[model samples]
Target chain A: MVANIRDKAAIVGVANTAFSKDSGVSELSLAVQAIKGACDDAGIHPREIDGFATFTLDTNDEIEVARALGCGDLTFWGRSHYGGGAATGSLHQAVMAVATGMAECVAVFRALNGRSGHRYSQGVSGELLTADAIHWGWYTPYGLLTPASWTAMITQRWMHRTGVTKEAMFEVARCTREYAVSNPNAFFHGQPLDRDTYFNARMIADPLQLFDCCQESDGGSAIIVTTPQRARDLKQPVVTVKGVAQASAQGQEQMTSFYRDEISDVSEHRIAAGDCYEMSGLRPSDIDAAVIYDAFTPNVLLQLEAWDFCKFGEAGDFVLDGNLRPDGRLPTNTHGGQLSEAYIHGVNGLVEATRLVRGQSVNQPGKQVDHALVTSGVGIPTGGAILGKLD
Target chain B: MTPEEQKAFEDRIYAYVGVKVCERTAAKDAVNPAMIRHWAEAMGDTNPAYTDETWAANSRRGKTIAPPAMMYAWNQEGFTVTRGRASDPQTDMVELFNEYGFTGVLGTNVTQEYFKEVSPGDTLYLEMEIDSISERKATARGIGYFFETLATFSDQNGEKVGTQRFRVLKFIPQEQPTAATGDDKLEVPTRIPSPRGHDNGWWWQAVDEGKLLIQRCKRCQVLRHPPRPMCGECQSLEWDSIESGMEGEVISYTCLRHPAIPGYPKDPVCAVIKLAEGTNLVANIVGCDYDDVFIGMKLKGRIEQVDEKTTLPQFYPA
Candidate 1:
């Protein structure tokens, strides 16, 4: 059965540390700061937050975050895997906790020093030669092992089958950069990229240029989720949890799902999108804004297609038309995205969605943002959610 | 066959056979596509994608590709004299005399996985750690010998690539009296001089000189000539050079011989040695030739300039 979007659990607060290339702060410190900021923003004591959700890749443990924030007792604590895909999953867990009366108010956060602390851009090493890595032995010996390179394989095939041009991929980057230009918290604020710059950027993989990839930043973000009644008493305007869903397809593996029947198809993400739209009882047109996961620019485009914002292979054209701009049809990532904003594994994206519904986004759309869609990582078991203005 | 008799036979064999230990070195800037390709070509592979970038770009497989097994093509850096380095001919001959003294060593292939494809430009840092060593008693050719070693290979980023399990054969010479066996008489032959190169003299010299060496083709910049003279690269002449530095990590390694080599020892051990200088040298490692020669073991070179006219280099534990 579908849940009422306007009457579900609400977001009581949202907080984030200043995004920077080097925060000079430890991951644990960032997590604590965001959690404290969130509690303060919600006008609630830290002890009231009994539920927690975070990314699996986060180094900050729940116990550590809890102890630092002086959390009295945690009734629920969980982590979602698949890197950026965990963004909405965190919120999903929090909403589930609130809906079930497991916890009154839940805190979901992601903190990291991705750029300065541990960079994932470096190539593979002998450490990958384990029994698990042996699967790549079949292809790596032939030179195809980096994350971007692996994704490129699918991107190339997707373009081949769908006739999506490189220009179409650039539109996604262009829009995100435009949104980032106005977002003070975005890493690329005031420095939007152009199509020419995007095209001329250095290629990390065949189709993935440096600009096409997401930015790595050091920062933290947290959101407070509570019941609608509790949200009305909090300091910030309530943004109700509309709908959420997570899905993993049959042939899922880490990065090597090459054995799948079709490379261009992300049936898993499409399935999750369907569930999100169904449970929310909201059509694609009802969403006033979105915080689509942009770990890679092409993924954003692919996600648009998967979500039925447009037909498959038409996302490039949809983006090129400026339909996603703030003044256009649906503004996205008003605080920028992983591509421009700090990528705290997509948790920041959820925080942005909450801001949109609260009418607090720096790049706020011309219309009153009543609903927003947010997605987690792609190409893996992923999750998504829809947020709406509480009645 | 009795345990006491076996102990006595192994003790007599140990008096002859010796041991050597190798040290380790840091492997930085070891991963490169060109270097990997050079090593692969030397191993008798003809895949055009490894060498010709233009061909690779045009090929259906996309860019240039390194063979999965090519990581094991270089020599490891490190050395230690574990045993048998100082044995005289009498002791060595005695070690080979008793059939029951030969403890067999066998190298097994565990598992390997590749994530990103390795190309020519990628740089790899590698480190190796010795996992463990064990000794066992065995009888070979009616002679008895003691145990051997097993080693594991770990890459620079702390990934394990391969492992080696090895053992040594020791026999008492004919002159050495053996405990009587019921109705079983043994005859030991006189020690004959092993062929000059066949005795692995070149390898021993390289270890002594602190320089690893691989036979390379002077004409084509190709390396070959470990087991034979045909160039795997350009099929040209087999010229050789003393490889500089004991600073390469074992990308991959094997401890067993294939079924092809005729008269090959029942459990002969070999490794595809990726050298610090980006060349892959294949040879039957000696000195501490136990199953312990892991994938990431660091090895150094010992050079022996034979007969003022020719110089030979070999690798030992670094």
Candidate 2:
């Protein structure tokens, strides 16, 4: 049976450090600050945070973070792999920990000095510890190094088959930038992306321009999760976890899964979407807003299609129709997403999902958000989760 | 180069797009059993469909048939391709790039989408068109231009059997020290060497000897690539290696361009090849124009020394 996680756990608090090109501090400092801020927002003491969950790529260790926060004897710790793909999976682990009584309170956090210390956009180099590098040997020697190039290879095929063009991709960037204009924390706040500016932007890879890529900012984001019964006493509105799941579809291989039958298909996203919906007893139509991962603009379109927000090959048209706008059908990335916001991996996205559910988003849509869908990265083992106000 | 000169070259090469390289070149011989048996023997393929006429005649095929990958082999120009054929748009394009300082050439990728199967006695014809050309850009392979071509194959009755897309790069070779003498040479960047662990070291060892080997399960007779200790079909540790025919067709490919990696030519065109042995291998295609490589295009592999310490399986047009 699917785990009956609906309404079992609640996000009582969400917080993030200022998004910037350089944090001027170690990733551990950012993690401790963000986690402490989250606990304060939840009306809990730092000592109350008994569990820690994060990404494998996170430089902060659970014990280090726990010690910094003065957290009591930790009962649960979890780390998910695959970068942004583990965003929701980290939360899924926290929810499982709280719901099963393995831990009373769990903090799911991600901290990165992406621009200052280790810029991810620069591309892969040096020795890799993961076995995925074994397969990457085939493409790396050929200059297929960066995440942008890996994404472009798959996006190019999708565009070829679906007839989607850069114009549609521009809509995703432009729309997300509009949301950022109102979000003071967004890196692109007060700056708007025009069509000509987007078109003239240098190509990172064909079909993906500078604006099509997300910001590599140094920041931290954390969310507090606990059983609904305990969360009822928290300071913030209860944003319950409706559904959450992680999936690694067949033929999965990090970002270089070119050997699959259909390179464009985000099978992991589709499977995770199906599982989340089945577990929550909710459908795409119920999602009033979404913050699909935007590592690249094309990924936004691919995930929109994978989650069935629109029919396959219709995501371009959907965005072109203005569905991603604040006043439109399904307002998305209200805090500008990774595109205009800061890239704190997917942690910040869950923070935005919580804001949408609480009707506290800076660019809150005119319509009430009953449920908001949030997903992690694509072209790798990935995941998603649904958040909504408790009934 | 002057901006005007760059514009002139761009216009000239871009003009080749949509131009036909070959209209209808017929295969030198009809599809026959002799070549099929030879290919099967070289591939170590015992599918019975291509070799056992009685078994094939009684099966769904109703008669002996050729492997779909054999489509390009039937029409290969053999030795004539080395001298460059007259009136060929691909050759003309390469000449135009070579006319500029971009003299180095590398076949990058090929992708073939098969629609039908060809049988013995069926005659084949080939047609090719210049599909697209890329602008001159900086790459790890030095400054270069990339071009692509689409090749379509059809049977005698005019039924389309397959189409292939090939990409090639024409570039100026980057300068580097030729002498392999310094201790820092080991630290200097080179092609990300293939990981040869306990399970697959023997395979890399064979490639060093100029052979491509596929692991065969001793019990089930299943062939697998990227060798492992156990067979997936049947749980068995007993396995042996079969020297691959090396001749194969491009199944899929890509030309990587951004964040140019070290120890690699600019815009390395990578491809997955379906070996004649009925297994797949990932190898670089070189010594031909990138656009001239395409799906279903026949290629022959040779283990070549790429750097001081590395010898890898690289492919060239058959």
| DockQ scores for all predicted structures | 0.02, 0.19
Docking class of 1: incorrect
lDDT of 2: 0.85
Off by over 4 Å in 2: A131-133, B1-188, B241-253, B272-281, B285-302, B315-318
lDDT of each: 0.66, 0.85
Off-target runs (Cα >4 Å) in candidate 1 are: A1-6, A123-142, B1-318
RMSD of every candidate to native, in Å, equals: 23.1, 12.8
TM-score of chain A of 2: 0.98
Writing each residue's lDDT as its tens digit, candidate 2 over B1-318 gives: 898999998899899989999997889989999999998899888889998999998999798888877777888887898896665778888888889888977776566778888888899889999987776766656798777788899999999989887777788987746663355323333677767677767887887788889999999999876666898789899999899888988765556555555456555666677789887776778877667766668999888887656778888999
Error of 1 at A246 (Å): 0.7
TM-score of each: 0.56, 0.71
What shift in Å separates residue B158 of candidate 1 from its native position after superposition?
47
lDDT of 2 by residue, A1-391 (tens): 6788899899998899988998999999999889888888899998888898999999899999988888889999999999899999899999999889999899999999999888898677656677766666655655567888788767877887788898889999999999998899999999999988999987776656789899899999999999899888889889999999999987677886665656679999999999999999999999999998988999999999999999988988999999999888889999999999999888999999999999999998999899999999989899999999887
For candidate 2, what is the DockQ-based docking class?
incorrect
